[model samples]
Target chain A: MIAENVAFGIIAAAMALGALGVVRTKNVVHAALYLVVVLAGGAAQFILLGQEFVAWVQVLVYIGAVIVLFLFGIMLTRAPMHPKDSLDNDLRWPAAVTALFLVGILVGLLVHTFHADKIHLNGPVRTADITNDIFTTYIIPFEVVGVLLLGALIGAVVLARKD
Target chain B: MLLNEFLILAAFLFCTGVYGVLARKHAVLVLMSVELMLAGVNINFVAFGAFHNDRIGQVFALFVLTIAAAEVGIGLAIVLLIYRNLHSADLDDVDTMKG
Candidate 1:
């Protein structure tokens, strides 16, 4: 549908542009802020794909929690507001070019491999279907992830505790 | 679109993140770059799940979400710890651990 293409195009464009801001910005704080934009854009893209829950998680987790901690760390450290704090050394363009070349090659290879004919495509998994999977087949992993999160919380507290 | 569009988008995001990781010097920026890459992978997982009639991608994404949250938590904590010790978040100034 024309609607899907337009929505996808807009979200994709926003994500890509936000990404450029993330990389191109010299200020670390600004980069962190730009990351919020990128994450939000990605969330919008996810929603358009019909994964409303995932989109909410993307917004809630990345924007709400991760970025808040990121900003807190910046403040705690008195992190430089600008990127000129240190390490102005630049990478050799040739190296950058080669790495980009490899990335392009890898992308091409992956595209060819996951091509449409190769994939037995199915329709978008409706909300009820995903709910069923979450409660039934994925119940174990769902619970296990809680344990993982607990470990992370403990680790964070331990790391932050000052001597 | 098919799986390939998601794959391509993920790849593009991953590559952009990689480039940012490789190119940036500041520690916090590096962390942001890593998160970008993880998000890209998460999108790929969800997309694949939708296309395959499996909920595995969503589960994988949930797992990734957990890891990313933890990663940011620990990363910021370490950043604070490092700042306490070094007074700077510059990777160049972090030579004490290198040699």
Candidate 2:
């Protein structure tokens, strides 16, 4: 559908621009903020594909927790809000060229994968089915992830605090 | 939405993150770049999950989300401790850890 393609384009453009800001920003906090935008755009793309579970998780976990932790660490460290030290743009040319080349190869591969005949093709997605599968087959790994988070929390606290 | 569009976005995100990691002098920004890359990987997971009509990619993305959260928690804490000792966040200034 025209609507889906357009939505996809808008989201993809936002994702790319946010990512560019992450690379172009001088302020570390600004970079973290740009990453939040990028993460949100990616989550939007996930939602556009009808994967509500993944999209919500992306919003909840990455934007909510990780970036907040990074900000806290930056604040706690007394890092210069905007020090005199210049942000390095030394490899800008080479890196940009590399990124462009990578994009070209990826687009080429996409074209190869989806021929013109498949333009209007689509399949089904069901939230109920995915939920059932997660609660059934993925129960153990899901529980383990919780335990892993606990371990990580304890370890991080131990490593971060000093006597 | 098809998988290829998601793949393209993921690829673009990854390349940008690579560029950021290489270009950023601030250690915190470098960590942000790493998170950008992880977000790309998460997109890939959900994309595949949708295409195959399976929920495993969601599970995988969940796992990745957890790992990324843990990574940032530990990484930032370490950065804070380093800044406490060194009084600077510029990567070039943290040579004490190298030698």
Candidate 3:
């Protein structure tokens, strides 16, 4: 239990700092790299919670595919690699305040509601079980997501194509 | 592990994403922030799924991941179009709809 607590603490701290870097960094490319840290930390968090499949999927999809897409987008857009003052606008302080307020409300409500609860993390959910649940109970949503992906693919191609 | 820890971490991540979305002037960065927010939600789903001993939560997170991928694809496409037209990826510059 103590080990779990410590592991969670280290990973969560890393994720928190990465999240901050993503928002606060002036270099757009560095922001993408920071996002990698946060996503990797998320995978570790999933592993700690005994969800290995989700963790790997996170690594494969988020770290592998999504970050690559972001880098491509950055390259195509030709955003400055060097730090610039125009990354943020006039609402920085207001945005920070709003975020802080949101965090306060969420943390307070969560603490109040689930202060006494504990997670067993005793065993990982079988991948077979997740697959079965998806095919049986979540069949419709699964199909819908497939269709959505196809639509997004076509839409992206059409939207990005030259006239 | 206490459930509150996971939930609190998720909330913090979500709010930080919110800050990025509101403060970032670049469209691509804004989309990245949205991904951050989705990741936070994904953690919540996985944590609760683990807590309840249900596989459905993991399934839900999977769906969220799929949707996030689709969103990024479509969003980046749109951003590319905007950049092509305006030669800038900054969100503050794309105000053609301002009446």
DockQ scores of the candidates: 0.57, 0.60, 0.92
lDDT of 1 by residue, B9-67 (tens): 77777877877777777777778889989988998887776677567777678679888
What is the docking quality class of candidate 2? medium
- Sorting all predicted structures by TM-score, with the top scorer first, yields 3, 1, 2
Candidate 3 — which pairs collide?
none
- Candidate 1 on A30-60: residue-level lDDT in tens? 8788888878877776666667677788788
lDDT by residue for model 3 over B1-99, one digit each (tens)?
Answer: 999999999999999999999999999899999999999999999999999988878999999999999999999999999999999999999899999
Candidate number of the best lDDT: 3
Chain A TM-score by candidate, in order:
0.82, 0.80, 0.97
- TM-score for every candidate vs. truth? 0.88, 0.87, 0.98
Per-residue alpha-carbon lDDT of model 2 for A1-163, expressed as tens digits?
Answer: 7798899898888888888888886676787788888989988887777778778888988888888887887788665667676676477678778777877887788678763422232444566777787689988988888888888888788877885
Residue pairs in clash, model 1? none
In model 2, the clashing pairs are: none
Which residues of candidate 3, in runs, are more than 4 Å off?
Answer: none
Evaluated on the second chain alone, the candidates' TM-scores are 0.93, 0.94, 0.98
Best by DockQ: 3
